[model samples]
Target: SQQGEEDPQALSIQEGENATMNCSYKTSINNLQWYRQNSGRGLVHLILIRSNEREKHSGRLRVTLDTSKKSSSLLITASRAADTASYFCATDGLNYNQGGKLIFGQGTELSVKP
Candidate 1:
């Protein structure tokens, strides 16, 4: 069974706007990560918030975790047409012995219209 599931499923915004996506998961996790994929290609790691960490940021991207709610959110500021892609949240599952394995959510497709 999938451990994580993305909410909304899709998002659309114009350049300079902010894009937000969310994810919810079941079971305890060592960490939660956000990733982006362009043109159906491989995913690019964005940011990760450890189970003990509440938030993290990278460049124009921000990630927040609320373990109490088993949920996480990703915010992308200054949206660009290039940012149009599929955003997914992933979890490492309940442990670390999994050898860096990741279980991904259904993904939220974001379109940054020019």
Candidate 2:
């Protein structure tokens, strides 16, 4: 499968702490996207890095991609309770339409203690 797999089924960190999550995939992809899901809420797009790009960042989030190894990592610096949410990585296949049919992995549940 071209799906991405994230490590650590869950995580808990104190407010102001940093949290890191890693993902690994099995096939080549046009791009990879990271999303945040708050409990029952819908997933929110966080960042997207193309296969040609090595890294990208948004606010307190940093993401890195290594196509050779088929892996990606997400880093949240200075995490807050508000930052607590489930994170997932999805692959955008070679085709745009195909990419839209995202296959999400078992996410990493994050809890930020206030």
Q: Which structure among the candidates has the greatest TM-score? A: 1
Predicted candidate 2 versus true structure: per-residue lDDT over 24-113, tens digit per residue? 888778889899999999999999999999999888999999999999999999999999899999887786666377767778999999
Candidate 2 lDDT (Cα, 0 to 1): 0.89
User: Which one is best on lDDT?
Assistant: 1
Question: Each candidate's TM vs. the true structure?
Answer: 0.95, 0.93
lDDT on C-alpha atoms for all candidate structures: 0.91, 0.89
- Model 1 regions more than 4 Å off: none
C-alpha lDDT (0 to 100) for residue 100 of candidate 2:
71
Q: What 10-residue stretch in candidate 2 is worst by lDDT?
A: 95-104
TM-score of 2: 0.93
- Candidate 1 structure, TM-score to reference: 0.95
Candidate 1 lDDT over 1-114, as tens digits, reads 888889889998899999989999988888999988998599998888999999888999989999999999999999999999999999987665889899899999999999
